[model samples]
Target: MEPFALTVALPIFGLIALFCLPSRIANRRAKLVRNLVTTVVGVECLFALSLTVGLAVKGVPSQSIKLIEVWRDLGLNLDVFVDGAASLMLMLVSFVGFVVSRFSIRFLDGERLQGRYFRWLGFTIGAVSLMVVAGNLLLFFLAWVATSFGLHQLLLHYRHRAAAHRAAWTKFAISRFGDALLIGALALTYYAFGTFELTELFSRARDLATSASQVTASHVAIGWLLVLGAVTKSAQFPFHTWLPDTMETPTPVSALMHAGIVNAGGYLIIRMSPLVALAPTAMISLAVIGAFTACFAGVVMMTQTSVKRSLAYSTIAQMGFMMLQCGCGAFSAAMLHILAHSLYKAHAFLGSGSVVSQALATTGAKSPQPSPHLSLAYLLGAAAISAFAYAAVSSAFDVNVVTKPGGVILALVVCLALTTWGWRLLSVGEITTMLLGMTGISGLCLAYTASYLAVSHWLQATTPLFAIPPTPRFVLLAIALAFCALFWLHFVVIRRVRPNWLNSLRVHAANGFYIDTVYRRLLTPLARS
Candidate 1:
């Protein structure tokens, strides 16, 4: 009856029904069951959408309802918590589920094990919804682990492939390690503070901030430990190998991870961002790793022949951007990127598949699942970047080595990726049309990246980041003027020049320099080894 019940209960019930359905759909009865199951999922998605609309109109804090209370002696009560944050995440999950569902209508038109797929789909959306709305650490952690295991199951839904099974095992194995770390972190918090309550922890944090004691600094070690748990789960560097490998699953599931599940990392980073700030070093570690992942992954994106692998790297890059923001002490900036990127990335990946599918038609062969590029050096590069991201994203106490983080500097990293990509595409893509499409997309990315500065500006005006104000307006103004220079050249000089100088400059900016070669060189030895 409660919102949380509808949010949590209905999906769990659907999962039970789905799990009960036979694996092989041979009979009329089985087909009927599968259809009914899909219909139910559809209903759940619609309900979530309606809830989102209401939230937009009235905007209630993320709303959650707890169903049961066990272990009352231990101060453990199962509860749901919702606010703007949870609502946003739930709404994103719901919509992504529905889109994937719509896609499955055509994507899995006559597929076997339809029931298994649909059921897990419902369960995933539900678990994520529960995750967003969970009230306390116990509830959130339960949902977190459930979703993690559920993803493992979903990854292996197709029964035959050794690779699929292996990917599933990898997810499960990594998630279990992450689970242990998460539980350990929670245990420390509980032992130190005396409760497993989220609100209580926040209050405790505020009190500690006001206190003057070495013990308070010790509190930060626990916070970083918790951050480690979140990073591993979210596929931040060092642990990111599993993500692109996850492509062994169906396309829709791939979409779910990129557009929805993988986003859980961003959600956790934001949800606990306040705590992360307590250890600024850890927060910057997040940013450094994030920025490098973006830059590194983007370069790797160039090498991949398969569209899917390229897109996977793009997702990695997006995750990196979110981490960079976290590192830079731009919480809302990161949050906004997460939301915008999810929707657009979903559409882009879907569109990319369609384009690739057309290429498959030319061969008249059973369309190969796009090749998964497992580059050795890239993995190690990612590992190094992960180390940097870790330091960059940390909640820093002092500025020293923490400032350097890893991979490379953010400005250099991005300049390199964009420059390399733009130039390569310009050289390869033959027509004016292709260049336009390419530049438009690149510009959109640049806009997103630059917009952060503006938001960072406003955020600084309103709140203090490490007791320092935002960058001076003169810098931002200069950045803006630089862009204006290009705009001016585009309209005035370019037409007269006859060569479209603006287009050429766009080509130049896109090259991101010859940075890709350097990355390749850095990675070659690792790749071979």
Candidate 2:
């Protein structure tokens, strides 16, 4: 069988079995349901794994298979496009789906709604796989909508809970609005190019680039529309409240939503790199919003008391960071972020129930803060060591550093981390131990940078390298500097300062700067009416 068909078929068959099987059968033969779903998803993961391995060994094949001929003259068809990006996404979704399915087998063992949960889970996984591999705008859009509805079923699993219902409704509303923007973007793309085929659209884009018309307002509008849809889907800024509130759903659903589904926004942006990069306004908007959202979400995350809610805010921050990478034309870096975050967040959400116990276990071993007088020396040591590490890693890995703002900023972040680590080691006041610790930290930093560069290079096949616009790139650098400065200030104030004014500041930060409250007051009336 063809790879694309197999990719879509395995999951669909599982979903069909899930939907067709009787509820009575599921309840009475719960083991059967578990085995059947697990086996199906396991096989699907194997298929994706094989596809990924094949692609890795043989390189990406630029071929698509059309299953239906909608209109011969207009280039309309039901097509499954296979490429590095599609394969990577399919592998990620299927692998996560399989893991989640296995987990649910044990997690939801005796629940009355086990069958219903797996049913929607299977459908959602299948639909998202289809969306990732979709060859045209129509198929992608249709699958996108289907995935949304299917996920809604999962999100609202506890329909009796008011919070679950509210969160699901909020998600539904935002999803619908995003769906509309995607449709509009699709319509505009069709209007501009006269077809929805991905390859053909990109080919035409290349052609238009060299022409006198270069890029028109319609193309720019499409880019903005696409960004809006992505922002909403990924829960950036104001569209983000629903995600945290969505903690009312089951833990497994939270894992899936954060790890795999929410990543679609970044995927969309990266997938459309050829087009989005052409629209300066769209790029700027993505960067600005992404920067703000990252900062806002990170601050909010710090103040979150609940484990799940904190995880939710962390997701928001990570998603914003991913979007920022895309906006900076660091598509490959963004893809790396997506892949890494998906795996990490999946583990985080799945294991969140253990957080309280873990905290209790570690409560007695907290490290003491270093003296404030050492801050200046620590800062200097961090700067020097980080610079040396950057040069060493860049040379050893042969990763291009100076050419891209993303690479530069990433190196800076590595330096920041190392600097903090070095500061703590130096605070010990033992020269021999400090020297040994510094050597170990340096080696670790080298390994991390080298490994990251290697993975990013491998993923470059799927994600096109992007060039940042000067203005937005400057804005990104400014944000990075501001973040670093604020981080240092936060540490200094918390450790050294005894000012009473900061009490109110801490309160505001804890309340998310009252942004969500303001939003509720303003939007509640609209929601009621």
TM-score for all models, in order of appearance: 0.68, 0.90
lDDT of each: 0.59, 0.77
**For candidate 1, lDDT tens digit of each residue in 1-529?**
2553355446535643454445455223445644664566566666666665565566453344555676677667676554556555666776777787777656766776665676676667667767776667777788888788668778987757766665566666667888887787777767777776665665566565554373354467666776777777777665666676667787888888888888887777676654555665676566556655665565455445677777777787778777766666656566667778889878876676678567777755332222123222323333344344333433232223223322123333334334333433343324784456355544544564456444433233122223312323343344334433433343233124335654554454344334434434444453333
Best by lDDT: 2
Question: Which residue segments of model 2 deviate by more than 4 Å?
Answer: 1-8, 16-30, 71-74, 363-367, 421-448, 451-456, 459-468, 471-473, 493-498, 518-529
Model 2 clashing residue pairs (backbone): none
Tens-place lDDT per residue, model 2, 1-529, is 3654556555654564465666666667777667777777778778877877776677665557787899989788988777767777888988888899888888998889787777778778878877888888888888888888888988888888877776777778889999999999988998988999988876776566555366888888888998999999999987887888887788988999999999999989977777776676787778778878887887778667889999998999889988877887777678778888999999999999998899898777545666566767766775687678668867877777767646666566667667767766766667896787678767976776665665565566444334435444577678688668656754555455646766666678777776666556555554443
Q: Report the Cα RMSD per candidate.
A: 12.2, 3.0
User: Which runs of model 1 end up more than 4 angstroms from their true locations?
Assistant: 1-42, 49-66, 212-218, 357-529
